[model samples]
Target chain A: MSSVGAAEDPHHLAHGHTAAARDEGGIAPKRIVVSYGFWLFLVSDIIMFSAFFAAYAVLVQATAGGPAGRDLFKLKMVAIETALLLASSFTCGLAVIAASARDMDWTQRALGATGLLGAAFLGLEAYEFSGLIREGAGPQRSAFLSAFFALVGCHGLHVSAGVLWCGTMMAQIWTKGFRADILRRLLCFGLFWHALDIIWIGVFTIVYLMGARS
Target chain B: MTDTPPDGKRPWQNVWRSRIRTSLSYVDGLMRSVALATRRHDGVEDDAHGRAPGPAAALDAGGANDHAPGLDPVAHRASLIGYVTGLGLAALLTAISFWVALDRETFWQPGVAVGLCVLAAAQMGIHLVFFLHLTTGPDNVNNALAVAFGVLIIVLFGAGTLWIMSNLDTMMLPPVPR
Candidate 1:
């Protein structure tokens, strides 16, 4: 399908089916192209995270006889952060749904909810990091602490970037009013947001839940 | 356009809606998506029919037959039911993991950690299927290939590193295992 006039078709608007058959010379629809591109980027991102996961696994036991994750970790705070990120992901999905339907009002509301939840998660993470620093369990103290900070901090940085992207998207939608390019951007944002939540699943499982036990 | 009235005037539907109305409307929505996802194509073009995706569904006037018959334009809506169900399952998994982790004394030692791994994997699968819409559809072949390749590399890198590092640690310590 030609990307230019695809959306202008009334049937496409009503149905939103962008299926590209194998015979279509390998060119997917614009929506699928952007979404699939983002999917590859996410896969590469996961590969990068696995390196840190390996590092953390190897170094988690090398605490240099100081405080370990069991001694310094707080499960309660980590649980809260996980919940916030999960909720934000759901809200981001809702925002995408609303954007697809061209419901400006609900899209903005859902995006706003996502941003607030994400910011709250960041606030809690910052609080946890500062508390660790104050308690003399900072990253400089041990190899384990450094690995922990690098893995979790990388995920936190992604969340920060996602929140900023979401804000900019809200503004673009408000001004451009659901243009095709804007909608593609919205799709990428939704995928990115969901990808971050998936990574957090790994972070909490490996770093917090398993780390505390091991 | 296929939305049937909630009124259970049909003799069979009377029992159905009565039993179902106690729960939120999500049950019906879930069933609908399940139906759509598993719908049979049977060599006929599925989108070749004039079925429009249900969008603005509640607010849309019942002009269901405006399109010409057999005019199938390809497009699909991301079902809201799928997202809600994904969220529900993920939340359940998270709660269970936390409960297991917090009450370590209640369960066996190493089993809890392994259980957390299973739960995390389950939750990640849920997010991929529902939120990311990963599927076996023809258009998704390339995406699936990319994911499979990435997973292969990750497994090799992570497992290989752990194996070597653990062996190195044991050799370094030469501990009381002797």
Candidate 2:
């Protein structure tokens, strides 16, 4: 079937019969293409993060005899950050369930919760970055500092984007309800949000934890 | 608009047709695997079948049944709880790692540092598998594949860059002036 035909077929939307049939029959072109497309985008995102990680690793020791991670990092603060991000991921999963069920209110609530948690995480990160800068451990102080700022800042930027995306999705749910396009967007958002959480795990491990020791 | 070629002769048509054929083959292979796995486990019957003999016989013999065709709320809730718990645990682990790194004087020993790094990587895998649900399921195998490919590229490039640059710094850079 033509891609446009597959997308527009009301049969596909009616009780999702078409989708079920395609799955059962092992012939779902649209699903495969959509899946592949999302994967391609994910791969590209990973590449972007890899570049940042590489830079950070290269500059890990540029402290100029300044205060190192051992002195600057607050385990309590990082714990809070991790909690916020992880909670946001949980809420994100709830949002996906809501979307799948076509429960607009639950979906909006979950998305809002996700956004708030994500924003809280971002706020903590910004505060951490600022605190470092205030203590004269700014990115300008060392090569290590620069890489640290860039890598963590890049992640912070993604979290910010997720917040904005959640807010927009909430608005869309309110306006358009749980339409296919919106659900697709939400699925993609879920993937993106979870991917960030996975990457943050690396950050917590490599940059903060390991750097503190080294 | 003037004159379109026949469907069989159109280049775009041929390309799409071939793509569809290839995708069908892939799906066929996946379905075969699912069938084989299911068949391999088909002989196991639980005690529920033994206790409810009549009901079980009726079910086995294909009798009337009320089927609620909709989302499974309990499964959904269970999945949500699992994800929440996983995330919470990951957060706790991250905090502990940070604490150990900051407080323990011997934590920077090369072996210890490498162990810590490996722990972090394992934490990442936990988040992916438990929280993100990136695994080999009917709905998510493609996602899992994507993640695997992406991770491969990131590891190769990130580790390679770090290794090369660290070597360069040691060999090429002049000693720091006192």
Candidate 3:
């Protein structure tokens, strides 16, 4: 109604008016909007990881006459890594619980625990990589090693990022006093941390479990 | 008219003045248009931030003075239960996978492969439901949709790669004389 042109285009005006009406009625809360968007991003990330998984699956048998998974893998080390990662996921969930309750002390404690566990997992992984490299079974050794490092190493990078994010969230909550925005960020971090664990499960079963046997 | 600087000492004053005027007007016009576009869409006044009420804040505004907590405390407790269940299930699944892999000789190889895949899928579900809190409720439909789409893409990618690459391998690899 601001211009004669707007009046002339009744259909456009009507569409705009209806869209405004829908905004009033159908506007989602911020949590849903943010979480839904983040969920999509996580899904896209998983899709990218699937491409890597497919490559690894195809190349798993292609040791190129070099040492295979059974010759190189240490299941005990992998098992410990899995346990550490799983415990961290659980602690992350606890952090979410504490954050939701506005229990600052518990939230910090849980986040600290989660970070430590994540650090432990990364430490073990670094040790594994160093040992493997020491033994000359590094990524360049064979197609199998290449795929192995690509998949597991990518996961390690994510965990590293998650640890950093956890630390940042703790600092934010400490300084900001659990403001709503900070809480929202904490929720996002929790989702990210849990998604990493889900991906790790895939890595464990497919790469570690199946690879050793195959 | 003399084309001279207004200050009478600086030769570039007039030129600089014109340039500043042009830039200021440009910025003013930009601000006006942005204001117009953002003004009163759908009969509601847009806040300066132009953001809608988020779930937690909206609920807080609805007179639930105690809603400042991230979500319902009861729900948090319930989710704690979910976390425990998920952790136990995930741990059990990992143990089974390791057991199957380490034993190596008891089950048929292909059967073991199939079993591992199944266990992995189940563990992923536990994480999604328990850790991520993804559900099938109407409020969670979008999250569920995203997850389903991701699964579809992964299946297509993995299956397609295996099929095409395996076939190519058979054709390309030189046959060894037995």
Candidate 4:
């Protein structure tokens, strides 16, 4: 831990400088602080999701003999949704890279791709939910369904917001031309989109795969 | 340091003792140097920004960060290869998850659920590292610390719920034969 003092400044810390210790006042360049603060937001967001996850896990078996996950989950559809989200996450990361370079054209392209893929994912989800409701297995049917809807629906809501964010970022870049503030927003958007993919990993594994396995 | 050991000390024990003593002194020296460096850095932030303190002052020339993830974006500077690799690996993990769930016979029979969980964990880790770019680096200590705390909370919350709920479920009468 003492080795951290060797870093000449926090910026050098990025290069793996052997021992740059943050000063006592903890004064940092605004960017690092912002990056870290946004991460905290993302972490807090995940913690919120964990509560929903706990609820879902607890009530997963309380289906009251209504349609359980195995009867309703379609693995084929889920696989497609996962692919779409995973692809969007990847595109979002690339958009950040392009935004960092201030490459307006490619940045716009990547962000566009991210928004489109996310929209497609949400479309599939809406279809799935509607189909379930059509078959009388909606959230009102049982505790299990309710938990599933709440957890997965919350994530879908986040993705919807993220998609909207991506669109707005594109417009801002178009008008502002990769301004410093715009780029920062892009990075945050990247983090948010990636974080959503991570949550979906949990949802698919527990709610869809495990629920449908039997 | 304790003069000399009494009888029962073997030759290898003497060697081990020396190795430990040497490492401890090395660590001690490192700590001292770090302490000196920290003091040196105390009044240097402004100077580092204003003028070149030494030969390396030419750096830090660009990129004032915004209030939102700004510093990290400039510091880390997202790259093409990393995002591509992350995407490929994530896609592969998703494939394995679906494969394991949909078709169990071709793969190992037992523990399908366990395998799914393991795959999910691996995929989450890949996403965090590649897409999120959280690191154990000195600059990224805050990110690491924040995430560690968050994960601790999540594990405690989820695991506690499952444990308590399952126990309660077991204690309840079985369906009352209705």
Per-chain TM-score (chain B), model 2: 0.48
Return the top candidate by DockQ: 4
lDDT string, candidate 2, A1-214, tens digits: 2232255464555543443233333433343346557767867987898898888877777778877777888867877787788888888987876565455777888899999999989889989989898989898888888888889999999889888988898998899886656666777788789888888887887777776656
Clashes of 3: 1
Q: Write the per-residue lDDT of candidate 3 for residues B1-178, one digit (tens) a residue.
A: 3855566646576679899999999767634543443332323422233435443334323323332112232222223556777888889988888887777578776788888888888888878877787766545677988899899999999999999999999889687899
What stretches of model 4 exceed 4 Å from their correct place? A1-26, B1-75, B174-178
Candidate 2, residues B1-178: lDDT per residue as tens digits?
Answer: 3355765366777789899999999767644543443343233221122222332233322321211112122121213445656766777677666666666565555566667666677777777666555555434456677778888888899889988988887788677899
Ranking by TM-score: 4, 1, 3, 2
* Candidate that beats the other on DockQ, 2 or 3, i.e. the better one: 3
Clashing pairs in 1: A16-B75, A16-B76, A17-B74, A17-B75, A17-B76
Relative to the true structure, how large is the alpha-carbon lDDT of every model? 0.77, 0.69, 0.77, 0.78
Flag regions of model 2 displaced more than 4 Å: A1-32, B1-78, B99-110, B173-178
Clashes of 1: 5
Among all windows of ten consecutive residues in candidate 1 chain A, which has the lowest summed lDDT? A16-25
> How well does candidate 4 match the true structure in TM-score terms?
0.76
Residues A1-214 of candidate 4 have per-residue lDDT tens digits of 2234333445554454332212222355555677898999999999999999999988888899898888898988998998899888878876776665556777899899999999999999999999999999999999999999999999999999999999999999999886656666777888888999999999999999999976
Pairs that clash in candidate 3: A30-B54
- lDDT string for model 3 (A1-214, tens) is 1232244455575654543334434656566678898899899888989999999999999988988987888889989999999999999987876665566887899999999999999999999999999999899999989999999999999999999999999999999886757867887898899999999989988888777776
**lDDT score of residue B42 within candidate 1:** 20
